[model samples]
Each structure stands twice: as structure tokens, then as C-alpha cells.
Target chain A: MAVQVTQAGADTKTGVSGWSLSIAPRRGALSVVEVIVLAACIAAALTMTNRHGVDIMIRTFLWAGLALAWNIAGGYVGLISFGHAAFFGIGAYTSTILLLSYGISPGIGLFGGALLAAAAGALLTVVCARLRGPFFILSTLAAGEVTRIAALNWRSLTGGAEGLEIPAISSATDMVFATQWPYVGLVLSYMLLVFALSVWIERSRYGYYLFATRDNEDGASAIGINPGVMRVSAMALSAALTAIGGTLFVQYFLYLDPTHIISPDISFEFALICAIGGLGTASGPVFGALIIVPASELLRGWLSQSASGLYLVLYGLVVILVILYFPSGISGAIARGWAALTKKKTS
Target chain B: MGGADKKEDQLMLWVEGVSRQFNALWAVRDVSFSIEAGEIVGIIGPNGAGKSTLFNLIAAAIRPTSGDIRFLDHTITRAKPYQVSRLGLARTFQIPKPFRQLSVRENVMLSALRRHRTPHRANRLAGETMEFVGIDHLADTSVASLTVGLLKKLEVARALATEPSLLLLDEVMAGLTPPEVREMMAAIAALPSRGVTVLWVEHVMMAIMNVAQRLLVLHRGQLITQGKPAEVSKDPAVIAAYLGEKYAARS
Candidate 1:
């Protein structure tokens, strides 16, 4: 076993470690790889028709951020929340209300929304931390449903189900960009920031506590670590990050409806990405976005406005297949394959 | 127990008049004991004797119905389990509770990580502790693959990783072979030399007798006897509680 670990370590040093060095040295090679990938994506985005390409890029980047945020609590902590859309809706409504009614700068609204989402996530954590397995899932689902209903009925704040549309920014302070390239740049920057934060959290003491709590709550507590606090903190950070994505989403689309933002499907998509990419792995969210975003776009394009339900069916099928064949998701399968290959080579 | 010597050997743990009731049935009743620093006290009782419950009280895994426990000059009668652990105490479960997905080394590292914030130091300490428990060979092996004996040793290694001053071990030798039992006994006996005190609950008589400075017998939720191993082994109360006619026939 020690020999196996030594060999694995040596292999990782040469390949993954080299990659780590090229990026941010603190983040190892993965950061470098991400930067390279982002640059290539930008180059690809430039090749398409200016308007459509930029829109897709901005939306994709926002989804990537949301996926990463979901990974922190659902993946790393093994909490498997199915109600992140609650935070997304909260962020969108908070930002929209602050901007249109209070005349606050959209940037301030973004920060305000994120803080609100984080506070809500913290509140949910206190109620749901001790509930595990299916009960936790049920509790979160109920919470999301309540948030959705509240958003729909809160006519004064949310403008009810008809939704609210932001007028043209008419100013730089609104965080509004003039062209598609600027929007893409803004979204990509936020994506990278969220990605970096997720990686940092995963390597920290709190991350270890989250992982330990997931592995053995009693054992974690026996070591004087408070699993409840760790889990709540993770969830709060995750929700805050997701809210940032939500704020950007509203800005890019210029609209916020409770149904659009707080849809159960959005939450399911976040879970699907984590499941398909490999929960609890640093690279899983990136890999998940790479597959899910393009596939979803293609599915929608093929369905061609008439068959939206078909896209849903396809998504459901993909989720089922991924769960059935690779319970640990794509990264887990890849890790296993790599291990087998390494063993075969050594033998 | 003279005044000065008693002061020098002041009790590290004091359990006084602790009891727990489930309706009319008393699971434990007025059980009290004191343990001083550097003591290796053995708790032995037949199944359902509430020996495990007593350990739970000291570890604060469960709250007593009534009574107080003072540890290190503070009353920790209602302290949470994790809080109890933070106050320089650690314990192993009767059934080894190795973290299933973690490697043996990683399992130990998790506890060490709590003590040492830096990963490098925690990893090094984990390796050393694993080697000490004689399971260093299985360091990288996922805990799911370990044998029962190796798992028990891993549990001990994990407890040791906390750098605890007081250690509680429950039935660590429950299913080990004779040689494995001896190996465990030697490792436990060596603990005090490294400044760790042990309170072990064991059904294995020989292993307990070999390592314990004093033997404590629990019967029906009360301390039946406690003394030097040789003296306690012959006490009529202990004999009545544990041996009965079998002891007379053997003698």
C-alpha cells in the first residue's frame, strides 16, 4: 500500500503537479490549466457572431459558477442539497428590488443579494444540519418550495409572478456592460473567482472538518470539531457564491421572474452537474460544466422551440444513466481507470 | 492515601453519584469513581453490566441523570462530547469505527489534523502513530480492506493522534487472537511512558491483568471491587459478582 501511494505520488508530481506550477503556484497546476482553458474558450467565443456567442459565454460562465458553488456544500460536505434555487431566486429578487425600488447601484444590489442568500443558507443549515439521508433532501426541497411560493405571492417586493425587468443601466455604476465581450469578461472573471474560492475552501481546515463530518459525524465531534458549525459555514459560503451567479444572471438576461429563477429544474441541474462530474473533487465542477452546458445547449437547439419537454426527458435519462453506471460520477470513474492503468504498467 | 500524596495524585477525573433512569429501570445508579493522573485502570464486567455506560458518562457521550464529573479542576457534568474531547481526552468505541472511505493513514490524519492545523505536520504525525500501532504497513490501504485486528489498531492510532493526556479504550481486544492480544497489551502498557493515561474496558482477563495497575469490577451498575489485580481477583464480592461456584470449584 505504501509503495502504491509512493508511485501515485510520483506520478501526480510529474503530471498534475507540473500542471499546478504553470497556473497559480499556490493553487498548483490546476489553476494554470483553468486559465489556459478559459483563454481557449474566449478565443472560441470570439470566432462566433458577436452577440449570440457572447450571450452563450456569459450564461455558460454563470452556470459554471453555480455548479462550483453547489459542489462545495453538496459535494464536499456530502449534504446533497436539492434546493439551491432558493438562494438563486433570493439573489435575483434582492438585486432587482434594491436596484428598481431603492435606486441602489446594481453592484451594491449584487453584494446585498449575496449576503441575503448567505444568511438564508445559514438559517436553513441550523434547521437541517442534523437531518441526513433522504430527510435532509426533503427538508431542503420543502424550503425551496416555500421560497418559490413566497416569491410568487410577494407582489410588493418581487412584482409577483409577472416578474420585473431592469431598465437600461444608463450608467457605469449599474455593472451593466455596453457589449457582449464586456459581459463575457465580467462573467468569466466572476467564474474564476468562485472557482478559486472553492479550491481554497476545499484545502482549508474547515474543508477537512466538512469532509470528516460527512465521513463520520460522531468521530468528527469526538475530536472536538463542531460538525454543525462547519456544515453551516460551508452552506453559507456556497449560497453566497451562488447568489453572485444569480445576480449576474439577472443582469445578463435583464429580467427576474420567480418561476424562472426559483424553478426546481435549476436546482436539479446543479445536482446533476455535481453527480455527473464527480462530487467532492476539485476539478469535478469544471468537468461537469464542460459536458452539461454544451449538451444542454445542443439539446435545446435540436428540440427547436417545439419540444422543450424532450430536452427535460433527455436530461432525466442522462442523470439516471450517470447514476446507474458511475455512481461516483465521471471524475471518480476516471480516477479508477487511471489507477488500474498505473497498476497494469507497474505489474 | 496521605494528604500530601493525595494532593500530588489529585484526581484527574471524579464521577460522583451519577445515575440514569429509563422510566422505572435504572441503567446506572449512583456509580462513582475517581481516577488520578498516569493511572491504567481496568473496567471489567459481564455483558449488560453497564460498564460501557460508565465509560460513556466519563467521555460525555451521554449525560447522567444526576451527578457531576470534574476533569482537570472543572465540572464537566453537562459538557458535550466534543467539548469533553477538546479538554485533552480521547476514546475508542467498543466496536472499531474506522472511517470507511478514508485510508488508514488518512483516518489517523483526520484526528491529527484537528490537533495540528498544518497538513504536513499532521501527515507526519499520523505516519508515526500508525507505525507505533504496528499498522504502518496498511497506511495507504483504504480502511474498508483492513482486518478486524488491524481496524482496532487503527482506532487506537486515531485516538493517539489527538495527542491526548487521557485515553479511554473499550473492548479493544474483543476479537483478537492470543498473539494479537499480547501485541496490543504491550502497545497499551507502553502508552504511559509517552505520557498518556489509559482507562481500558476489556473482557480479555489475561490482557487486562497484564497491563492494568488496578482492576475495577463493575456489577449491576455499581463498582463491585477495585484493588491490585491479585487482591481484587480474590475478593468475595468480585467472586460472587463474576465467578460464583465456578471460582470455588477451580480453587
Candidate 2:
């Protein structure tokens, strides 16, 4: 009789609200342990690079930096922006233009480019912060397209679609080293900056507010946080960090193409990196890049060398699977598994 | 019961001729009431009598169409809800809205952090609030896992985390059992001892009678009576509003 009544209640509309109220335990220990694991992984990455060839090491570090920068706003703040490539392009172009055209050192151009990206990001956020969900995403994508078009048209500054070539700097202060050592140092420094900023944000009160805002904006506002300001600040910080990554990319490659820098593929990769690792977790992006970059390179090596689009298709499939089954990504899944293990052990 | 001394000295929140119009109709029209400090004032009326609407005006969740609200000697008619909270005011929703993804401790910690800038101090305050609300046992529990009664307690805990001098509780005792109601009343009654003021709205007349120092009866957005609990309970208007015209006519 009780089971029948329960079944009837489940079928009825009256129990809809009650059914929706189903609660789940939050992931807590995962955040702390992930950070420690990420730190170890970073050390391992640095060491492995010294042992292996420098090209692989430098590329890995660059991707790590990019992932970390993208995750600051997308993962932590829950503003899944697909226009981070605009900031990347801005930084690359700014540095490349300063170096190739005005004879400014790449070192000074790095800071200059970052500042420009930060300013642009802040302005974009202010205009688009009122838009929620997909609207915000679309607006940012549009902004990135505008930037890409500007870069393509601005012939004198950006060298039109032919791209800018950064000459080799004879001086050490110019930041163009003759060997892979300089690239390693540059990538490691930016990665450290990203790590420090992510740590600071995770520990800060603003970080708490950002999470709260992402989860529920009304609740955050009720608790005295202005969600707009928090989101904008997060985006600006994200842009600055991403710009630094762009600077490092230019310095390492010694070349910049507008299409390559401002490509939608790059933005998609950033989102994919965060999603594959864990969206909201601090170390998720690093984990994501670690897995994806290598897997991608390996796929390229094994399959046709020209199968670049296959990586994206694979990413899209993973994203779908993650959304449907895991919803928390690989890091989140691992955390859940660990929790279950611990619970089983305790029991 | 609306005496000179009570009117002159005890008025902490003054709502003068406030009205909230929606298109052609007034949801709350020309409602005026003043609540004194350290008093648990209960506002009771039928559904859509604008009880919640009036509370929203006082909490600055919505601005009054035309009126002034002076809270703690400051005009807060146009102040935002957070601004009101910062000025020693806090409120709970009809349905408890706990930060579902956060732990019980983190939910209270968010409120404490809003009121206190530093994390260490906020955590301390959160601990004290959880203890006070008798939910310290469930401190580490996820808010999603809490029962309705526990969620209500968590709501109160979060409100108290703001260190509010004035608390606006909306139907906090609505769904509780009699014993739970008594327990909640005792907890609310003890709030004044900590220098916190309460303005509660409850459908449960017994809980209101038990906890409220004074009562203000509202019928269709207008104050019908204001007096001591005993006096107001016996008033013809109050009796009529609650028990219907037949009882009032017979009495």
C-alpha cells in the first residue's frame, strides 16, 4: 500500500517541486587535493622538458599557460567565454607590432600587449555583463570576429593578412633567445603567474562570491555581492593572463598571423580544455591540457598529419559525453570516485 | 491600544502611506505601520492581502510607488536590499533558499563574509551562528541534504550571520509541527536578548501569539488593528478577519 501511494505521488504534479528538491553532496576535498597534484605535475613537466627535446617541452608549457589563463574566468567565474582568442590576438599583435615596426623590445611589448588586452576585456565585459547565458557567449564571439576583421584590414599595423615577422633580438634583454632555454623560462614564468593568480582567486572572498554568483546570481546579490563587477573583474584578469600567454607564444614562434591568433578554433580549444578537466575546479584546465594536448599530438602523429579538424571533432564528442554522463568532467569524476572509495573504506 | 507613548517612543520602522501599484490596481495601497525596536510584530492577512508585498517594501526588495520608510532613523525607501542588510537589517524568504551547492558551513560563511570582510572572522561568526541556530551538528552537511525544518533553521542561521539588528522572517513557521513551532518560537524569542529585533509574518496564529510582543492585523493591505497580543486577539476586527463575519456577527 505504501509503495503504491509513493508511486502515485511520484506520478502526480503535486510532487514536482519535491522531486526537484533532490539534494547531492558537494565536492570539497577534490579542490585541495587537485591543487597539490597539479603542483607535482608542474614540477614533473619542467623536469621532463629538461630530459626530452625542447620543442615538445616548450609547446606543452605554452598550452598549459593558455589553459590556466582561460580557466580563471571560464572555470572559476562560470563565464564560459569563447572570445579569449581576441585577447590572445591583441597581445600577439601588440607585441609583434611593437617589436617589428617601432623597434620596441619584445619585453616591453609583452606588458604593453597585456595591458591593452586587459583594457579591451574590461570594456567588453562592461558592455556584455548584463547578458546572461548564450547571449553573453554570442556577444563575445561577435567581438572576437570584429577584432579579427580589424587585424586583417589594418595593413600598416598588422601587416594585413600576411602577418608580422619578429626579427631575432641580438641582446638578451630583448627577450629573443638564440636557444630553447629562453622559451622554457618564459613559459614557466607565465605558468607560475597563472598558478599564483588562480591560487589567490580561489582563496579570496571575491572567489567565493564568483562561485556563488555562478551558482545563483540572485542569492549572491542578496548576500551583498554585485555579480556584474565580480564577473567583469574576473574577465579582465583572465584577459591579462591570456595576453601574457599570447606574448610568450609570439616570442617562442617569432611570428604572428592574425588568422592563427584570432581563430575560433583556439577559443573552442580553451573551452574544451576547461570542460575536459573540470569546469569549476582550479586544477581542471591544467589536467585538461595535459591529457588533450598529448592525445591530440599523438593522434596527429599516428593518423594523417593534416587531420587537424579531427582533434576538434574528438573534443566535441568528449564535450557531449562529459555533459551527458559526467557533467563534472574528468577531474570531477575522479573526485567522485575518490569520495566513493573513502566512503566504502570508512563504512 | 495605539497609545501616545507607544506611538511616539517605540516606532523603529515607519512606513507612511506606502502603495505599490501594478498597472491599474494597487496591490498594497496607502498602508501605514510603525514597528518598535526589540518587538516581534506579526503581519497576518489572507493570500494577496499584500502582506509579502509590504515586507518587500520594508526590506527594499521593491520600492514603494509612493511613500517613505524610515528604518533606524534613516530613510531607506529607495535603498537596495543589500544596503538594507548592511544597515543591520536581514530577511528570510517564504521558501528557504539555501545555497544548494555549498555546505551548511559554506552557506552561512557566505553571509558572514558579506557582513565581515576577513575570512577568519567570517568563519568564526559562521561557527557561532550555526551553533546558535542548533544546526552545528549539520554544519558539514550539504544544504541539499537538509530537511525542510533544518533548512528553515539554516535560513535563520544565514540571516543571523549578518548580525542583523532587525530581522524580517516571512512565514518561517508555516510548515513546522507544533513542537517544532514552539522550539522555533523559543529560538526567536531569545533573539532580542542578543540585541536583535524581529518582525515575523506567520499564518500559525498560536506561534504568532506566543512569539510576538505586539500584533498588527492587516486586511487587504490596510492595518486593521495594532495592540497587545491579548487585546488585538480579542478585537472585533481581528476576530472577524480570522473567523469570518458569522462569528463576528454572533459575538
Candidate 3:
């Protein structure tokens, strides 16, 4: 009925409430293994960029960032939006359009694009405030499709269905880079910025509010949580972050099109990545993006010659297994295993 | 009982001609009453008599079709539930709506957080409230796994943590055993001492009779009569509509 009805990210070591706060040892948002994983992510970003292929590493970081953004609404607030690509497209289009046509730098365009996407997100959620479950999902789908159509038809501004290209000028100020390493650096910073934001949210009072609002709306309201207001704010924040990801995407690719950027498939990818990693938990999205992005990319590389769509079919099978058996995503399963192992050691 | 303590009678709530209609039928029709500060009022009625609906109207979960409700000086007839709650009015559900994923303490912290900005203060407030309701032992337990008695206690604890001047509880004693009911009754009886006025709706007659200073009886969406519980219990209309002939004959 709700997103992540199973474990999700709710096994949160961020259990800062209860008797744990007073007597028990404080567990930071990330655990030991999680810390190692995060460190590895940084280590991989710095050294393995040249060795393990820059394309794969960068995509991992970017997808992880996008997944975390999606999890804020879909996992934490129980707003399963299949319309994130709209924000992504808005971000991509806004910056690319401004930089290419108006002689404006991409940095200023970045904030402008994010703000516009945030407003669109808040508007979409506020309009569909009364909807829940599949109805809300369907409304988001409709919203995404409408945006895609508008982007496709708005030729004079968007460069139409043909798409727009960024200047290949290699300048530090332009945000364009000659080597793949800077793009990797740019993507890593974006991912870390998003991860830090997620951790801050998980530890802050606002994090508790989002969890309460998502877990039980009426119960949250009884304590003075305005569900409508909270949902709208969350939608805006989530969309703004996702839009930043979109900007990163355009900067890296130097190209933008309605088909690739604004497609509903992109939106689904963001949500699916979160779900498969662990809904509602901080580490779940990172874990999901880390595993799925490379796995699918590798699978596609190997399977394309033998059979078309086989990799995706296999990917679909993996998601179904996780949703059915794991339910809490890969992070949850790992947390549970870690718990059991610790319990045995102590006993 | 009109034999109330009678000292802290500062009109906490005023409901004037309140009526809530679902389409044509009035779920609560022309119900009017006033509760004094620090007084515990019990509202009782048979099935479909609008007891829960009255609580809903008072809590601003649903707006009344007509009339006004005032909490102290605030006109709350059309206020949103959160706004009403923020104005020192808090409510508990007939069926407890616990945050299932949250630990019991976290559930209470959700309410306490409104009163205390810092999580530490909220945590402390939640602990104190849980202590009041005698559920301190279940602090770290997940809400989804709580038993019925503990769930009811958690429900009361959550509302109490909000630190409301006025509390509305709906059927908190239902499904509880004799010992659980006694424990709950004792907890509610302690509300007044904390400067909390209460409006409780319950089918569990014995529990309310022990806690309320006065009683209001509803029949068919209208207030049949209201007075001291001792007096209202003996009224002919209340006896016939609710307590019935068997109890009437014995009394």
C-alpha cells in the first residue's frame, strides 16, 4: 500500500530516539562496512578512474546521487513519483539552453534550472495532494508525459525534437573538460553533495518529520505536522536535487534531447534504483546504484551481440527477486545479515 | 458527577450547536456542551450515535456542517487538524494510528517534537509522558509488534507527549482486559493533575464512569441529555436509549 512496506531503510541506525539516546552507544548514520564502502567509492573515484574505465565509475556516482534524490520522496516520504525525468529534463534544458544561446555561464544556469525544476515538482505534488497509491503514481506519469510532449513541441526554445549540443570548449570556467577525469571529479562531488544532504536530513528534525509524514500521515498531523506542507516541501527539495543531477548529465554528455533526457524511462530508473538498493534508508540508494549501474552496463556490453533486450530481462528478474524476497532492498538485507552476525558473536 | 472538585473551572472548551452531516444524515446533530479546565468529561453512546464523529469534529479532523467550537478563545470550527493540535488541543484515535515503522519512543517523540524543538528535549518529554502512562519499558520496541494493551498505552502516550491543555480520547479501553482497563483508567485519572482537561469517548462504561467528572450521552446523532454521571445514569431517556430495561430494572 505504501512504499517500502517491508523493511526499506527503516532499520535505520539513526534510531536517535528511544532509550538508545540516553544509555546506548550512539550509532552514526553510517556503520563500519558502510563507511568502508563509502571510502572505497572515494578511493575508486580518485585512482580507478583511469584503470577501471572512467565511463563506468562516473555513471555509478551519478546514478547513486540520482537514486538518493529519488529515495527522499519515494522512500522517506512515501511519494512514489515516476516523473523525475521531468525535473531532470527541466534542469538539462534550462542550463544547456542558457549557456549555448545566451552566452551565460553554466554555473548560474545550474541554480536557475534547479529552482525551476523545484517549482514544477512542488506544483505537481501539491496538485496531486489528495491522491495516494497507484493514483498518485498515475498522476505523476501523466505529468511526465505532458512535460515530454511540451518539450518535444516547443521547438523555438528547446531546439525541438532534433536536440541541442554544447560547445566543446575546454575551459575550467565553462564547466567543460578535455579529459574524462574532471567529469568524474564533477560527478563525484555531486554525488557526495547529495549523500551529505541525505545524511543531514536523516539526522535532523526534518528527517524525523519526513519519516513520520510518510509512515503515518494522521499520526504525524496529531503532533502538528502539516502533511500537505511537508509533502510539498519534500517534493521541491527532492526535485531540486534531481535537477542538479540533470545538469551534471548535460555537462558530461554535452548534448540534450527530449527522447533521452525527458523520457519516462529515466524517471523509472531513478525510482527503481532506490527500490532495489533499499527504500527509505540512506545507504540503500548508494548500494543500489553502485551494484546495478555497473552490473547492467556490463551485462548489456556482453549480451548485446547474442540477444537483444536479454540484459534488461535479466535485470527485471533481479529486481523482481529483490522486491519479493529481499523487499527492503540490498542494503536492508545486508543490515539484517550484519545484525545476525553481531548477535551471534555477542551471544 | 456534579460532585466535582469545582475549583479549576475555567471553561476550556465550548461547542455551540455543532452538527456534522455526511450527505443528508447528521452524524452529529446540534450537539452543544462546555468543558471546564481540569475537568474530565466522558461521552457515551450506542453504535452510530456519533460519539467518535463528535471527537472528530472537536479535533478538527472533519469540519462540522454547522456551529462553532472554541478552545479557550480560539474559534476552531474550521481549523485544520494540525493547526488545532498546535493550539494545545490533541486527540487519540479509536483505533490507534501508531507509526508502525517507528520505535515506541519515536512514536511519542513525533508529538513531543512539536513542543520541544530539540530531539533531546523531545526525547525527554516522550520519556516523561511514557512514564505517566506506564509504558517506559516498551520505549525501544517497534510499534508494529506492540500488543493491544501496550498499543493503547502508546496511543495515549503519543497524545500526552504533545503536551496539550485539552485531550480527546476515543475508545481507549476497548479490547483491553480488566487489568489493562484498570491501568488505563489510572493513567487517565492522572491527566487532570497535569493540568490537562479531557473529553473521552468510550463504550467501556466502567472505565469512563470512574474517570469523568460529568457525562454526556448521545442517541441517534443528538444529545439526549448530559449531567453528573450519577444523575444522567438514572435519567429515564438515557436508561431507555442506552443502559436499557435490564439495567433499569436492577437499578
Question: Top TM-score: which candidate number?
Answer: 3
- Which digits, one per residue and each the tens of the lDDT, describe model 1 over residues A1-347? 22111111111211211223433212112545456666776676667675654566667777877888998888777778889999998888888888888888778898898899999999998987678999999898889989999989988888899999988654567766666766777777887787777666655666667777877888888877888888898899889888888888888778988888998889988888878877766666766777888788778888978877798789779889988887767655665666677779999
lDDT value for candidate 1? 0.78
Error of 2 at A20 (Å): 36
User: What's the TM-score of chain A alone for every prediction?
Assistant: 0.87, 0.84, 0.93
Docking class of 1: acceptable
Model 1 preserves the real interface contacts to a fraction of 0.37
Tell how far residue A207 is off in model 3, in angstroms. Answer: 1.4
Off by over 4 Å in 2: A1-53, A169-171, A305-312, B1-11, B239-247
Candidate 1 residue B8 Cα shift, in angstroms, is: 6.6
Model 3, position B163, has a per-residue lDDT of: 90
On residues B80-192, what C-alpha lDDT tens digit does candidate 2 reach at each position?
87788778888887777766556678778888887577555687898898998888888766666667778788888888888888899989887777777787888899998
Question: Which stretch of 10 consecutive residues in model 2 chain A shows the poorest summed lDDT?
Answer: A7-16
lDDT of model number 2: 0.76
lDDT of 3 at A279: 83
What TM-score, to 2 decimals, does candidate 1 have? 0.91
Candidate 1 vs 2: which has more DockQ: 1
Shift in Å, residue A84, candidate 3: 0.3
Off by over 4 Å in 3: A1-13, A17-28, A49-52, B1-9, B243-251
> What lDDT does candidate 1 reach at residue B45?
78
lDDT of 2 by residue, A264-347 (tens): 888888888877877765556767777787777666665666775686577567678876776666766665666667779999
For all predictions, the C-alpha RMSD in Å is: 4.3, 6.8, 3.9
